[model samples]
Target: MSSRQGPVVHKFGGSVLADAAAFRRVSTIVHSEQQSGAFQHGALLVISACAGVTDRLLAIAQAAAAGKAEQAEQELQALEQQHLGLVTELGLDRGELQEYVRRLCAELAELCRGIAYLGELTLRTRDAVLGYGELLASAIVAELLRRELPVPVHLVDARRVLLTDYHFGNATPMIGESGYLLQKEGVTGALQRGEVVVTQGFIGATPSGIPTTLGRGGSDYSAAAFARALEARELQLWKDVPGICTADPRRFPEAQPVAEISYAELQELARFGSKVVHPHAISPAVSGEIPVRIRSVFAPQQPGTLVWHRRYDAPAQPLALAWRERCMAFRWYPKGNSPLAEMPEIVDTVRKVLELYVVAASQGSVLLVTGPSTGTLEELYGKVSFLPHQFVLACIVGNEPSRWTWEALELLRNSDAVSAVWTGVSPVALYVLLEESAAQSALAELHGWILHTHALQRLRL
Candidate 1:
């Protein structure tokens, strides 16, 4: 009666396995599938650390960098205790896991000492510190599976598998060879034998043997990469929520889940802060044309959002309603009076510096928004010899776009809060610039406009 046909790759987020009960639930979930013959080809689970672990690890890094040795030690102790508590709760005998936890704690203490003594936390060092969460999670889950499940489970350090350059943070995969190594190195055989293998996400070792991490939420991308590597039939992301809703359930009470959506649309939603899938994760899977499922741990039976490559030509309605937050729009002008000549360098500098997805760019202007870090933007603006006085960045996303700027100004809008009237640059989105205080009012006003405007109500789904 089981519907699952072949090998499946499942990723569990931090919230899904925060403790023993959650881990047990996961075990049961995996157990049921294998028993019912749902996991016919086998399964691979990528696990994240318990909720709040990464934040704590980050705090430890920050504190150590700031010379707060005492503070860092306190936080490190708390993390150790948390892991120890989980082990005790699971009622497992103190064995390999205990040793691993002890080793991790010692390494963390050394990391703190290094930070305090060196007085600088480089990107490489910080990444090494941050990789602990995924490692701990992977280890614990592997141990748990061994204790509870009937299948043979193997633990593989992704560092050895997902090899990459020494980028430290935001490392890109050395795909061609990494995929080959993983396939040849028993990944294919393990799945063939119906053994469940566990691997860490986000953290991978560089070619130079230093720890490197795939920026935040890199786990999802890692899972997608793995699926593509193995050519798995389905990639399931077990999240805390049911599926991608029409709107954020917190923001819109009447929000409904989207049963299925195209990868392109999902990418747009992710860029606009949908939280449905990592915007970066879509590219690889879409190119491969593999179906990615976003399911909820709470409702194991419900069909969640499915991400695939499909042309959405449905009736004029929004597939999902999403908006970006902490969004700031930069309005900049070239220092030179000549419009077209200086455009390339100006745009290139910003691109090199920020590495941002340009929502709008022109010969004399630019607009940029980042949901993550602002380092790139800061670097570009700081190093580029732009005529500083020519630029004025505004929070244009989600604001009422000015109607009069259509002809002369190159308006670039990326946020959903802007009404259709303000978005003159494109037919899809309206971009605006405003302060944080006015964002709510801007959203409300735009909501009214969007509900009534022919532009906003039209959905391409």
Candidate 2:
């Protein structure tokens, strides 16, 4: 592990590590990388829990808090059995790992009993319960890597180094302090000694060591945080898809993969409706100027999408389309003679409260798009009245969306399937609101138009 390059940070999600076979594949990938001299300076792996484990853990917590201690214990036993089954599938000796899993389960059972007796579930307690999924999953990964790689594999508890605030469910990482702790806790030293480090993602601790989670889908953020701390060469996120696609392949069957994209474009896509990468995951990478590669675990040889700081100078065309269903548009008519300057503050407040996706302000009215969860807007209730209209939001993401905004709007407006449409534009994207019933068909038509138009333009060039 003596080399001229910095270490590489790799993140494997639950979808890619579904079972023992998937874990085996992960080891093979690591082994291949090692053989190719990719880990000369060392490598850090951030792992999510196995598929469905987090949900199951949440259910167990709810059951225990509802005073069904016996049922919670039964579910916990089944979870234990699942891990043991994975151990059997991997053909590993059941002595040490089996005993360790049982001890962890015993502690979980005690917590469940406590919750049952108290009859309450606090976010703090729920976070503690949810974290066990990653703790258990990472242990299995560590063992698998130990058997596969010639170098030493060390399992470091992320809670020891990744410090966050007291926000129980969606805590923000204290990057400066966390970086200092990561170096102080021997993570750098272990890598320098030629050891491959494995750690659980999405879990960190407060100043007093109370466990906290970074919300769902936070593992990508966790991986980026570690990469920033380690100053790694690249941050690789292993997913189940080929790469970032023009649209979700499941919903839009005609969707095609994007070869490369700028950080700003990807950030907008993620923020709007894309699920390929977490919204906050790109910030640290941007700050550190690290290139992120989203690769498929199934097809390891193929070079997937590369997300970097550079922008391409190609002509304007839709790079990708992302949509959100079950959204609502809120229109507010301002009071008489209210200056337009005041709209910005109101929009900012609404965006923070509702996590709004699109906002448009005109002379008389302001419109915002958000999810149906309106109970959180108590503070803004009387300040501005809202007229709710159910709509699905579709965003067209590209480098220079302003260039094709008019053409794209006209295409949507003429479509027989599309009914009423409201539109907004940003530097990187154009947002369209469509009736829920016609959204699917309208998106399909728009996607087809984009592909056909781009192909014809290429021929002319």
Candidate 3:
């Protein structure tokens, strides 16, 4: 019995990895899927750190780097107790489970101690410390899920198979090497025996074997990579939301759900600051032509958003909007006989150095969005500071850019709520920067004029 064919890839994020109840619920889900023959050859599960665990780990690492051993120790103890408590609730064998937990705790403590001794947090050391959360969480979750199923469950460390360059903080994976190692290592053999394999997401190893992490929010990309490597039938990402909505439902109560979207559109939405998906996650999915389904953990049976390469007669209009906060704008005033002529070139270089997204740019000014940062703000041509005004990104997905602006954006122009606008490279989405106070109203107006009304508009897929 060759079990059937290849593996099925399932990824769970921090949202469902919170506590003991969540773990049990996930185990029951696995049982139901297994009983339904969801795993043919085998199932490949990629899991993120427990909820709030990664943030805590980062805090501990930063504290240790700043010579705050007491604070770091307190965090370590709390995290250890949390994990042990989950295992206890699962009723796993206390002896071996406790020992495993103790070993991991000891390793984390030593890593923190080294950072404290050095009194400086280098990217490399930080990568090592951050990886522990996924490591410990994957193991605990795998153990609990294993106890819930009668089938064999194998734990595979992501670092062993997902090979990447030596980038310490944010590493890029080597696809060819990764696929080769995954096969040569026993993933195929384990699957052939109908065993479910579990692994940590967002963590990989360099060619020389030093641990590296795929920056924050890289777990989705990790799952996609494995989906391609394992030649999975489908890639399912379990998140908290129902799926990809027209706008973030939190902000717009009337935002509707999109049943299906192309990979390109989803990638653009993600790049434009959609927290529902990671920006880099679409690469492998597109390359392999795999269908990435976004399913909700709370309502598993509900038809969530499905991302594939199929498109019908649906014409693009305004589709979605994402809000990005705490942004900084850099502007270089044009000066006579000034050497700042290369301001544009400087923007290019700065983007490469920081890897932050350039929201909008004009002759002498540019807006950059960053997720929370610890380092001091880097200055450009102008003094760098946060804008006191509120702002949000309003993105409209449509094929005709000019028509979209003329039809749906007329209100924005008259309202003077717009500052700058840019379209994604593929033209699948139009990004408009808006004033914060008017964001809700502007979004509602756009949604009504463009989507709900559907006048002179093509239906969105």
Candidate number achieving the greatest lDDT relative to the actual structure: 2
Instruction: Write out the backbone clash pairs for model 2.
Output: none
Models, CA RMSD each: 7.4, 4.2, 5.6
Where is model 3 more than 4 Å wrong at Cα? 1-5, 309-317, 323-393, 399-426, 431-439, 449-461
Per-candidate clashes come to 12, 0, 2
lDDT of 3: 0.75
Q: lDDT per residue, candidate 3, 210-237, as tens digits? A: 9999888878888988888777777888
Shift of residue 369 alpha carbon in model 2, Å? 5.1
lDDT value, residue 107 of candidate 1:
90
lDDT of 1 by residue, 6-107 (tens): 478889888888888998888777777678765667788877778888878888988888999999998898888888787778875468788788788889
Worst 10 residues of 3 by lDDT: 452-461
Estimate the TM-score of every prediction: 0.72, 0.84, 0.78
Ranking by TM-score: 2, 3, 1
Where does candidate 2 stray beyond 4 Å?
A: 1-5, 309-315, 325-339, 342-356, 361-392, 406-424, 433-441, 452-461
Model 3 TM-score relative to the real fold: 0.78
Please give the lDDT score at residue 173 for candidate 2: 84
lDDT of 2 at 317: 72
Whole-model lDDT per candidate? 0.68, 0.82, 0.75
RMSD of 2: 4.2
Q: Ten-residue segment with the worst summed lDDT in candidate 1?
A: 390-399
